[model samples]
Target: MLVLAIFVGAGAFIWPQLHGYAVTGAAYGARVACSCRFVGGRALGDCRKDFEPGMDLITLTEDTAARSVTARFPLIARQTATYRDGWGCVLETWRN
Candidate 1:
């Protein structure tokens, strides 16, 4: 019971920050990939190289019709950024 309580306490304290990290990371990734693919005129496929070397869990998807990119970290968080023709990338949502 003591161990379980300790685990629960730790989880409660840690989970929110963990989620925050994932959300921030995904948002940054989305913005970077969007800029690379749209403003920089780089191929969408090549934007995978923009992610940090160890961050294989993050995934990036592109929507040609919307001119946007989305980055997701499984169940934790996801963020999308859209590219305007002359303005570069802007986040679709204010929060991740």
Candidate 2:
């Protein structure tokens, strides 16, 4: 029981760091989070946030399917209308 407790505690302390390492970008900066510059891709699905009067924000879907990266690291972006604005994204399919 003591060994199990120690192992669990160690994992808890190091899990975040491990997760950080799992998330990596390729030669181009295109990770789950849109922190770097990347070209626009296709729209995979419908927009979740539709723009309306007085609505300043809108959500659009794009294809971030990369064939060289991990499927788990697929990227998504949320952009605003009228201007080429972008927000962070989460990877879905690197090769999907």
Best by TM-score: 1
Best by lDDT: 1
Model 1, span 58-96: residue lDDT tens? 889999899999999899889999998677899877563
lDDT of 2 at 40: 33
The CA lDDT of each predicted structure is 0.88, 0.33
**What digit string (tens of lDDT, one per residue) describes model 2 on residues 1-96?**
999999999999997775443333221223321322232332222221221242222222333343212212224222211112353344444331
After superposing candidate 1 on the true structure, give the runs of residues whose Cα lies further than 4 Å from its correct spot: 1-4
- TM-scores of the candidates are 0.84, 0.31
